[model samples]
Target chain A: MANSSDKQNRLQRLWTWFWSPAAVLSVGFTLIAGFLAGILFWGGFHWSLEMTNTEEFCVSCHTMETNLGEYRETVHYNNHSGVRAICSDCHVPKEWQHKVQAKIVAVKDVYHEAIGSISTPEKYEERRLKMAAAVWKKMKASDSRECRNCHEFEYMDFTIQERRAAAEHQRAIDTGMTCIDCHQGIAHSLPTGYQEEYQKISEALGVPKLGEEMTFSEAKSDEIRTYLDQ
Target chain B: MLQILGMIGANMLSLPGILGLAFGMMTRKWGFAALGGALIGLLEALLFAKFDFSQIDAIEMVISILIGIIACLVGCAIRRKGVLI
Candidate 1:
C-alpha cells in the first residue's frame, strides 16, 4: 500500500515539472529558431551585388570582349601596380546624378545587343567610336569628372602648365592644328595596331600620310605640328 | 557530384546553429543560449546572402569568420563565468 502511494506521488511530481516555467521557456526557443532562419535568407540576397568585380560579369556580352582584351594588354593590367580600373570606372560618372544618367544611356547598349545590330568587327568599331565620342564630350564638358577623381588638377601647378599649354594652343590655332594632331595619346597608351589603323583610315580619307614613325619624343612630335601647319 | 557538393557547401550556413543547440542540450545549460547562437548564425547567413561572391572576396570572408569566432568565444566565456557565479 505504502509503495503504491510513493509511486503516485512521483507521477504527480513529474507531471508538475513538465508544466513548469523551464519547460515553457524551452518551447519558446522555437521562435528563436525561426528568427535565425530569417537571417540566412537576408545574407543570400546580399551576395549578388559583389559580381561586378568578376571578369565574367564585365565581359558577359561579346561586344565588350575586344576592348576588355585590349585593356588587359595595357600598362594598367601589365605593370601590376594593382591599380586597375575597369570600363565602368572610367566610362561611368562618379556622382549619383551622373550614375543615373549613365544607367539610362546604357539602355541603348542593351537594345543594340538584343537586336544584334553590332554584327561585324567594322560595325563594332564604328559603334565603339560613336560611344567613345559621346563619353569624351560628356567628360570634356564636365572637366573629366571621372579622371579628376584620381587625378586632381589642384595638385599640379596648372598656372605654369596652362601658360605653356596656352602658347602651344595659340600656335596650333594659328597653324589650324586639330586637337588630336598634338594630344593624340592623352588618355590611353598609343598602340602600334591603332597607329596602323590610323594610317589606313587617313589614306582612305584622302589625308596626307605622316611619313616618319610617330613616337612620344618631342622631335618626332614637332614633325606632326609642321605637317598640320602644311 | 561536384555540383551536389557545391550546393551542400552553399547550404551549410545552418550547421553552426545546429551545433550550438546540440552543445547546449548536452551541457544542460540555458537552452536559450544555444537558440541565441543559432539565431545569430542565421542572421550571419542572411547578411552573407546579400553579398555576391564578387563583392565579398576572401578578405571579407576572413573578417566575418573572425567575428563569428570571437562572438562564440565571448558567449562561452560568459556562460562559464555565470556557472562559477
Candidate 2:
C-alpha cells in the first residue's frame, strides 16, 4: 500500500511538471526553431520547381541544346507584351480534366527530347511552327483563359498610358492585324535566330510579310492597351 | 535596412508559433493556441501575399521588428493568462 501511494505521488508530480510554464516555454522554443528551419529550406524547394518549369527541361535531347540558350533569352522570360505564353501555359489547359490531355500532348515533346529526333535548326523550327499553329488554332476557338489569368483586363487597366494605347489597338485590329502579328516578339525578342530564315522563306514562297515594324516602347504601349480592352 | 524590416514583418505575419504562444496562454489549451496561430499566419499569407524581405530598405526593417516584438509579447501574455482554455 505504501509503494502504490508513492508511485501515485510521483506520477502526479510528473504530470504537473509537464504542464508547467517552463515546459510551455520549451515547447514554444522548439516550434520557433522548427519554423525557422522550414524557411531556410524553402529556397531549395523553389529552385527545383524552377528547373522543372524551363523549356530546356522539356527538350533535354542533344539536338535541342543548340537552340536552348536562345530560347532562354527569349521575350517569354521578359513577358513584355503581356501575351507571353510559356510551353506549358499554352499547351496545358487550366482545368484538372484537361491535365491528362496536356500530358499526352507533352509526351511527343518528351519523346523528341529523349530520342534526339530534331537534328538541325530546320527540324526544330518546323516543330516549333507546327506547335505555334496549333496554339493559334486553340486561341481562335477559345479565349486563351491561361493567358488571361495573369494578363487580366482589370489588372491591365491601371494607367493613362494603357488607355491611350487601347485606342490605337482598336484601329490596328480593325485593319485586320491581330494581337500576335505585332506582338510576335512578345514571347521571343524581335530578330530571332529564325528571323533571317523566315524572311528568306517568305520571299521564296511569296508569303506576304506577316509581322510589323514597331519600336519596343510603342509596341509595349499598344500591347498593354490590347490586354486592358480584353 | 528595409530588407531586414521586411523579413521581420514577414516573420511576425507568417510565424504561427509566435501567435501560438499567445493563443496557448490565453486559452490555456495548447492545441487551440497552435491552431489559431497557424490560421492567422495562413490568413496573412493568403491576403497580403509573402515576398522576400531582403529586397526592402532599413525603415521597413525597424518597423517590422517593432511589430514582431509586440506580437510576441501579446502572444506570451495570452498564454500566461490561460483564458483561451
Candidate 3:
C-alpha cells in the first residue's frame, strides 16, 4: 500500500514538473539556438549524402571494380569537351526526395557487400543480367531522368548529327523513347542474353513494344541507310 | 576526399550530441537525458551505418550520452541557483 502511494506521488510530481514554465533562458534564445542546430544538422546530413555519391566512394567496394573499369572506357568518362559524368551523375537522382529514397534503397547494396554476394568476377557475371535488368527497369520507369540531366532532346542539333543518329533521335523523341532504350551498352558491356532480359523487364513494367511502338520517320532514309552501311 | 569531409562534418558538430544537450536542458534529469542521447545515437548509427557498426560509432554514442548527462547536471545547477540568462 505504501509503495503504491509512493508511485502515485512520483507520477503527480512528474506531471507538475511537466506543466511548470521555464525558469531560465529567453524564448528567443532557445528558438535561435534550435534554428542554428537545425542548420548544422542539415549541413552534416547533406555532406554525408554527397560523400556516398562520389565515384571514389562507389569504387571503394571491391565488387565494383568490374563496373568501374567498364565505366572508365565509356564516353561519359572521357569526352571531346573534357566533361565527365561520374558514377553518381549516372546512377543517383539529383532531386531531394528521390535522392534520399535512392540512398535508403542503396543500403541493400551495403548488405550485399557485407555478405560478399558479388565479390568474385564470376559471381558478378552470373548476376549481371538480373542487376542490369533492375537498373534498366528503374531508368525506364523514370524515363531515363538521369540521362536527360545532360542530354536533353531539345538541345540536340540533329542537322549536324550523323544521318543515322539524327533519324534515331527524331524517332526516339516522337515515340517518347528514353535514352536507355537503345543505349544499354554505351556505358557498360551488355550481359549475355540481355535482349531477352530487357524484354522481360519491359513487359513487367507495362512498357510498349520497343521497335514497334511508333512508325519510323521516312526523312533522310537513303542517307541514314548509307551512313549505317558505312 | 568525400569520406574525410563527411566524417569531419558529422563528427565535429554531431546532431545527436546537440539533441542530447537540448533534451538534457529541457528535462534536467540526467538518467532521462542519457537514455535519450543513447537512443538517438543508436538510431543514427543503425540507419546511417546500416548495421555496420564501427569503433568510432560506438565512441561517438558514448560521448553523446556523456554530453547529455553533463548538460542535465548543468541545467539542474542553474535552476537551483535561479540564474536567468
Candidate 4:
C-alpha cells in the first residue's frame, strides 16, 4: 500500500510538470519547425524554376525543335570564343518577376497546340512571318530587355567591333534603335520573303525599315533641330 | 514564352475560388466551406487552363485550395477571438 501511494505521488508530479510553464516552448519549437519547412518549400519552388530554364528543356517541345535545329548551326551555339548563348540567354529576362511574366505569356502555345495551330512543320513554315513579326514587336516594345542581360550599351566597345559593325552600332545608339530592330534572324532561320513582310510592317508603322540605311524624309528638319538644339 | 502565359491564365482562377471560400465560411459549415472552396478552386483553375499540358497547373490548384483553407481558418479565428458574436 505504501508503494502504491508512492506511485500515485510520482504520477501527480509528472502531470504537474507536463502542465508547467515549460509547455510554452512547444509553441516556439513548432514555429521554428514551420520556418524550416517554409525554407524547404521555397527551395523546391526555385529549383523547378531553374530546371525549366535550361536549353535542353527548351528544345524538348516540337515547337522549339525547329528553332533548336537552326540554333545548333548558329555561331552563338558553336563559336571560336566558346561563349554560348542558350535560348533563355537571349530570350528570358534576368529579373524573376519579368521572367515569371514571360513564362506566363508562353502558355498561349498550349492553346495554339490544342487548336493544332502549328502541329506540322509545314504549318509552322506558313506561320513563320506572322510569328516573327509578333516577336519583333515584343522585342521592340521592351527595347530588347533580355538582350541587355548580356550586352549593355555601356559595355560595348565599338572600336573592337568590325568597322562597319562599329559605325552601325554607334549610329544605332544615336538613333535609339534596339538590338532586335536590326538583328532579326540573328539566331533563327529567316523565313522566305521576310523582307517583304518587314517592309509592309515598316510602311504601316511609318518607321524606317529596320537595318536599312536611312533615307530620311524629314532629315533633322529646322523645327526638330531647333527643339533638339535647345 | 507560352508557359508564362499559361501560368497567368491558370492561376487567375484562384481569385474566384478565394471569393467563394470567403463567402462560404459565413455559412459556418466548415466541412462544406472547406470542401466547397477547394472543389471550386480546383475546378476553376482547371477550366482556365485552356487545354495545356500544364505541368505546374497542379501547383496552382493546390495553392488556391490552400488559400481557401487559410481564409476559412482566419474567419474562424476572428469569430472566436473577437466580440463579433
Which tens-of-lDDT digit does each residue in A127-195 have in candidate 1? 665555454444534445676566543455445664655555555444433344444344343443444
Q: Candidate 1: where is the Cα deviation over 4 Å? A: A1-55, A157-230, B1-85
- From the highest DockQ down, the ranking of the candidates is 4, 2, 3, 1
List, residue by residue over A96-158, the lDDT tens digit for candidate 2.
Answer: 323333444455667666675666767776566554544544443334455654554445443
Prediction RMSDs, each to the true structure = 19.5, 16.4, 14.0, 15.0
Lowest lDDT block of 10, candidate 4 chain A: A215-224
Q: Each candidate's lDDT (Cα)?
A: 0.50, 0.49, 0.69, 0.64
> For residues B8-62, what per-residue lDDT tens digits would candidate 4 score against the true structure?
4333323533365355646556676666666656655555464454522466567
Q: What digit string (tens of lDDT, one per residue) describes model 4 on residues A104-194? A: 7766766786787887899989998898887776676566777887788789888797675676678777776667656667778778776
Which scores greater on DockQ, model 1 or model 3?
Answer: 3
Best by TM-score: 3
Enumerate the candidates' DockQ scores in order.
0.02, 0.03, 0.03, 0.14
The Cα RMSD in angstroms, rounded to one decimal, for candidate 2 relative to the true structure is 16.4
Q: Of the pair 2 and 4, which is ahead by lDDT?
A: 4
lDDT of 3 by residue, A26-97 (tens): 889877998999889889988998899888899999999999999887778887899999999989988653
TM for every model, in the order presented, reads: 0.38, 0.36, 0.64, 0.59
Candidate 4 TM-score versus the reference: 0.59
Q: Give the interface-residue alpha carbon RMSD of model 1.
A: 17.1
